[model samples]
Target chain A: MSAQIVAFGLLGGLVLYSAWRVATAPLITHAALFLALTLVGVAGFFFMLQAEFLAVVQILVYVGAVMTVIIFAIMLSTPALIRSGERPTLIQQILSPRYGAIPLLVGVAVTLLLLLAYGTVSWDQVPLTFHPSSQFPGGSTAQGTTGLIGEALLTRYIVPFEVVSLLLLAAMVGAIVLAVEGSRGKEDEARD
Target chain B: MTDVPVEAYLVVAVLLFGLGLFTALRRTNAIMILMGIELMLNAVNLNLVAFSRYLPAGLVDGQVFAVFVITLAAAEAAIGLGIVLMLARKRQSVDVSDFTELKG
Candidate 1:
């Protein structure tokens, strides 16, 4: 097999494994770390797919910004939540494990089946419109140019773009309210 | 050029989705489940980007939509996690089971 194939195959396996770990692990902090690994693996997949810009963005946004905030929230709000242990609860012993087994098996079985089916697809018949003239950001052509993505976002998806802006504003307001509400309650209790 | 089969991407998406689903449904910790949901969202985004590369369309619709999906997912995550934080500060626990006030 070619190096590209080997690299991509391993990358795919790594990503899936990390994702599975994220789902199964009990500790919130470990889950966060595993999430970072999953994101890194996704970045590798982007590289293998020849979508360089997307790959970098995957790491920068998912791993850097989103994850950092999540972990921070966990640390500040509940350090005990991150404690590593399977609690002796019914949900821990019987429910979650039992419930998780089905999806795990199905996910594995369906993936293999899909691989077999994909092996049968004819590549030459898969229509593509690759042009040598276009410079996809980060020298990748298998996907789209950054310019095209920007243009499409601003022109075609102006509504969603504006919606995202509103959503972010709402989130900021909500976070402030939640964090502040707790402190206010504590002050009221102290006054009593 | 080294070709990538569409099936490979599909398989990845399935696994990611399954993991996300399990985490969301089973995990007691709210943040972990949110992470799982993000994983699933990323899985769908992967499918979009893959098809944008290999599929019949020249419109790059897959990439555009995927970008929008990512943006929206991020916004949702920020808001959702913020609410969780607020709840955590008040309750001192992130366990979903602890929030029993919602049960009718």
Candidate 2:
């Protein structure tokens, strides 16, 4: 029990710190790296929460594919697009305190308010532990999380599953068109 | 069985959401802002999965929703990065303030 708490604390702390870095890193590439770290930490949380399948998906999707796409976008774009040397570093941005202060204050305040709100709620009254009797019907065992999820995705939730596939297809075509059109304009510019 | 309270998860989610809001609001760079949006989406996913765990034991709704959220996030990132690419090419700049010619 204590080990679990310690692990959660370590994972949660790493996640929050990495996420903070993602928000404040001056270099766009550095922010992308931090974003990957944050995603990994979230996957850790998913593991601790016992959703092993989701945790793996989190790593495969967010850390693997999404971060790769973000980095590629950063690299392909002109360096001038990423250079923000005029802007102060994170410490200076806070201490010299020009632009982002109000938003930071608002963020902290809202977070505190949310914590307080949840703190007041009665979590103990609700069921907190998984029960054998409550296990999903199709799984051979209660612990077959991946199998259970696959069953749910194909059976009870088939419509949304198909819809998500359609959404992915649309997004793919849209991204290709947009990227190709932009490069074509650059080609025309070069020709002229 | 883990002894951690569900609220611990919620707290993490709130903090992430807050930081994401700060990032989105403060950053002038469009990519940074997009990263912030991703962070916010992640926070929501954490909340959903956390709450889903405590739901009637057999219910995998939360995990299922998390998967869907991941899919949507991927789509969003693709389209958003596409727009960012377009913006970068159009203006030779990626600064959000510079791209505000659309402002009336």
Candidate 3:
């Protein structure tokens, strides 16, 4: 339990810090890297929560796929688009411009409200464990985390599964179309 | 595995969400705003998984929801990044503030 606590503290701190860096990093490339770190930290939390499938998926999708695309976008774009000509110092980046104060106030207010709600809830009084017999009909334990998730995905949630597949298909096609069109336009400009 | 309190997860979720909110609102880059949205979605997934584990039901509902969130986030990121690229190509920039020609 002590080890779990320590791991959680470390992972949680890393997540929070990197998330702040994702927001405040001056360069888009730096922000994307910090975003990847934040995703890895969240994957740690997923593992701590014993959701093995989620941890793997989080690492694969967020860290592998999504972060790669974001970094690619940062690279493909001109430096002027990725970062302002002025490379602000870290302190200046943290201070940001005057516009930052509004968002900061809003974010802090939302966080405090959530914390207040969390404090008022009596989560400790709630029973944490459920009978294994009630969950899995066979004599399997929670070690089969991935199996359980697969079963749930297919059996009870088939409709949403098909819908998500369709959504992914549409997104893939749309992305390709947009990318090709942009290149074509650039080619036309070059000809001009 | 129930040794950890649900509150701890909730606290982390709140912090992630807050950071995401700040990122989304403050950043002018469209891609950074998209990253912020991803952070917020991950926070929601954490909340769902924590409840799924701690609630007496112990069902995999939370994990299923989390999977969906991840899928949708991936889709959103692909489309959003494409849009950002096109915007950059069109205006020679990806800053959100510069794309406000539709402002009435």
Question: TM-score for every candidate vs. truth?
Answer: 0.81, 0.90, 0.90
Better of 1 and 3 by lDDT: 3
Best by DockQ: 2
- Decoy 3 TM-score against native: 0.90
Clashes of each: 0, 0, 0
Where model 1 places Cα greater than 4 Å from the true spot, the runs are A85-144, B55-58
- DockQ of the two-chain complex in candidate 3: 0.65
Weakest lDDT window of 10 consecutive positions for candidate 3 chain A: A130-139
How much is the lDDT of residue A187 in candidate 3?
Answer: 99
Per-residue lDDT tens digits for candidate 2, residues A1-192, read 588789989988998999999878877888899989999999999887778899999999998999998888788765764676686666678654434687788788888898888878787776676543224332346555787788889999999999999999999999999989998998999999
lDDT of 3 by residue, A85-163 (tens): 6676756654656448778889999999999987887866766664333353222564557877788889999999999
Candidate 2 docking classification: medium
DockQ in order = 0.50, 0.69, 0.65
Segments of candidate 3 deviating more than 4 angstroms:
A81-85, A89-98, A124-143, B55-58
Candidate 2 wrongly placed segments (more than 4 Å): A78-87, A95-98, A127-143
Compared with the true structure, the alpha-carbon lDDT of candidate 2 equals 0.84
> TM-score: which is higher, 1 or 2?
2
